[model samples]
Target: MAGTAAVVSFGTASAQTAPGPAGTAAGTTITNTAQASYTVNGVQQSATSNVATFVVDLKANLTVAPLGGNTPVSIGETDAVLKFTVTNNTNGTQDFILSPIQSLLGGVFAGDNFDVDNIRIIVDSDGDNLYTAADTATYINELPADQTRTVFIVANVPAEQAASLATVTLVAQIAAGGDVTRQGDALVSNGLAANRDGVVDVVFADNDSGFGDLAFNGYGRATLAYEITTRNVDLSIAKSSTVISDPVSGITLPKAIPGAIVRYCLIVRNATTLTPARNVNLTDLIPANTTYEANSITVGGIALGDECVLDGLPLSDAGGTVLPVSGITGSYDATARQVRVTIPTVTSLLPVAASFRVKIN
Candidate 1:
């Protein structure tokens, strides 16, 4: 019976304990002490046979580095490269999924203005084609534990959107089944999880150094004055009064007639610091009752007109043409800082005043 009981116990225990059991129990004591001792030993042995299972510990290691022909980007341009390294730090291989996140701007003028297109990930291990869902077979390839993989990325910046500095980010995740560990025939998995996040920044320098440091002089204060020189001019008439009689009348009649001319002179000066004195024009109003035989007149040897007259004689430049005057109807002198105009004759005209313009410089 003892041998039979032992055989039955062994069979039952082997069947229950193949996969491992949580607890062990000793058989009840009977009249035979040897059998009880054997049962207690079996219980102790069973307890020792139970094994505690622990899940495998998995970790990820990642690094990011900027790469490209044009590392320091300019405004409104493209064609740059970014490199990243991913490592599996576990007892077994792991599968990973990498995606891009928004990077932060850095350096002076970093955020002045910028734009970025979608990030492109290239898996060199997978034949260097652009990463996409169809390429999952190549991307999911096992990265042996304690091993690293390099990934290449292409970055593009529009010429117009370039700035002094810019920032970018990338995200990496571990796949569910790929992140599992086996301890004592039990499996532990971390499921899907974010393994790493990275940031990168680019910088640029100012192009213009010194632009707004030139000196300039503005308009200065102006001084003005006027002087009247000669007040009149000599005049003569070809004929004098004469006596005449009507053909029918025998008696003769006497008549008195006269003719005369008047001239006036004017002087003006620029007294202010404003350079290049200008001419001041003056007009004399002839009274209505005044009479003149002829209206022709001259000033400083120059003929005068009813609407406008030169201040002095008609001056010419080296080219033989009339010298340009600053004032439309008046005169201007840079050195003399004065202007002079003559009114030769005035008769039966309304009161008028001279007007001119001046600039302070």
Candidate 2:
């Protein structure tokens, strides 16, 4: 008498135990067995099926998410940093290839008008969630399952960029993990009907992350925006009039009456900004029934108490007068009765004042 051994395959039932983000670990061996008792052996004969085992395949998955909504940046800014988080959801350790892509006109990030310059991808080496000179690793290395790493998209804004908004997407591609010193090759899915014996295969189970990235591609992506703030110089004009002398009340308490000399001051101030205001031109018209005071126009005057001290250089009434020290130009038109002053630049540190005198008719 001899005992017979039989083997039954349950590929469908065993596939449920494959490795995944939350399932069994990759390279783990799973075994199953089947038992049968035949009627011919009613006296008590049973046969045990052989073991059917297969190694759990690797499931590559990851997710990328922006740390915040929008990264506000100013024009001509350099080394601007945008943050993101990359999580390894695979059942085993993995490496991620990081890349930054500028978005097109529309899609997940609507109204994307410009592209950033000098774009680069960098991993947070110190786990501080901030970009520093010490953080220089470009790709994620040996990131364990269920662990997250911070990443940065560093770029520079163009000096003459006119667009107000720019969008960038960070894409992380799953790669093999093992070596800690160098990056590994990118993972490719092994499409097979049955799991290979004693071998670890790969399967992509990631979800779509917009920007035309589809699921099951071992790629995860997230989008961030760079919003340009209004950093141009803010120019403010303040005008004040002071009577120099009057016929009835001379110098002590001047009044704006006939035959009185009056000075009109226009102060142009530039608020603090990234850049200074240039080509600042100011114009003033003589009041009705008033005569222009010859050679009365002063440029770059300083404010003393409430009156514009004529500390600035005087201009010739004949027109086309340029101040040598301040580079300020002034002109007067007798026919039009107008005074014009042109300043090359207005900065935040000081205010430029243009004052002219007119006499009552």
Candidate 3:
């Protein structure tokens, strides 16, 4: 009798890359067969063993991570974005349902004292990290295994939320994948159940996220803070008048008489700290029965004691001047009988003055 030998060959079905043993795709069939060949009476003969097969199980996992540390916002600001990244750690294609939760607990960030307004959840459709109108998908679509997508939590800052901080959390839940046109149902894990042949079994392997999201629940979460960096400025205006000269007295206790030249000063001050007043425009209607003096409009003047010295450049009544003050413009409206002064900014408690002269008619 001659020696007999048997050979076995194992074949695994084609599979997509996934997070599992040998990176095999879920529901893929692995087959193995044994063949025996031997010489019987100097003739060659062959026999084959039964084929055995098993399917790959599914591993459902995902994670949500904040892309940036803190998002700085301003009071009354709109469309402020807080970015995060969603990664599909599942063993197959998966969809994710996104939820943005406002955290009242302040332990996530220091000084979490407020909540943002008009909160919205958006997914990045174009792979760009920035938030825009084009990024309109509300839920994560079919994301392949080991792929990551960016998401945004947009909100509006309330007008009263000044110098306040708020915290927000982004939560992602694993859902059914396969359809590209719509979101699938939320996935439920089949825990420690017997693996069925040719059927994909679900297993949750995600770790417990520190932000109140538990592990093996097919869910993940991350938190971020929105900080108000700039404070709202408080502005107040004061107007005063002084008689420069008159027909009766000149530069000395001048009375309000005919042909008297009266100088008016409009001062604007910002009382808030850490923020400056911008685009400050001052308008004053010329007093009745008075004529505006030609080239008497001056802006960016300083206040000395109780007098407004026209140390700034003078502007004509028509809004033109040979020399213009820095970031200051003055004009007189002929029809409205008003004096207009535009100051670019007022930054401190020190007042900025807009001065003009009118003669009693």
Best by TM-score: 3
lDDT of 2 by residue, 1-361 (tens): 1111111121100001112344677889999999998666458678999999989988777767778666777676778888888888788888999988774424334456678899999899989899999998999999998788999999988766576777776878999999999999999899555667899999877755243566578877766777787557678888888888999989978888998998988998888654466668898888798998888888767787446967467876666555466667888888898888888778788888788988888
Q: Would you give me the overall lDDT of model 3?
A: 0.76
Error of 3 at 357 (Å): 15
Residue 10 displacement (Å), model 2 = 52
User: 103-179, model 3: which lDDT tens digit per residue?
Assistant: 53444455667888899999998987999888889999999887899999999888774447777778889999999
Kindly give the stretch of ten consecutive residues in candidate 2 with the minimal lDDT sum. 8-17
TM-score, every prediction = 0.29, 0.57, 0.62
From the highest lDDT down, the ranking of the candidates is 2, 3, 1
Per-residue lDDT of candidate 1, residues 1-361 (tens digit): 0001000110011000011111111121112122222346456422233333332233222222222221343333333445445443333444555554333212212232343554465555554433344432323246664455655545565434223333343333433233333212212232334322121111111111111111111000100001111222222111111122223332234222222222322222223221222122443333343332121222332222222233343422111212234222333332343332333222222212222222211
Show where candidate 1 strays beyond 4 Å. 1-70, 74-77, 103-113, 126-140, 177-361
TM-score, structure 2 vs. true: 0.57
Q: What is the C-alpha lDDT of each candidate?
A: 0.29, 0.76, 0.76
Whole-model lDDT, model 1: 0.29
The TM-score, computed over Cα atoms with residue i paired to residue i, of candidate 3 is: 0.62
Candidate 3: list runs displaced more than 4 Å.
1-22, 42-44, 103-109, 161-163, 233-361
Per-residue error for 270 in candidate 3, Å, reads 12
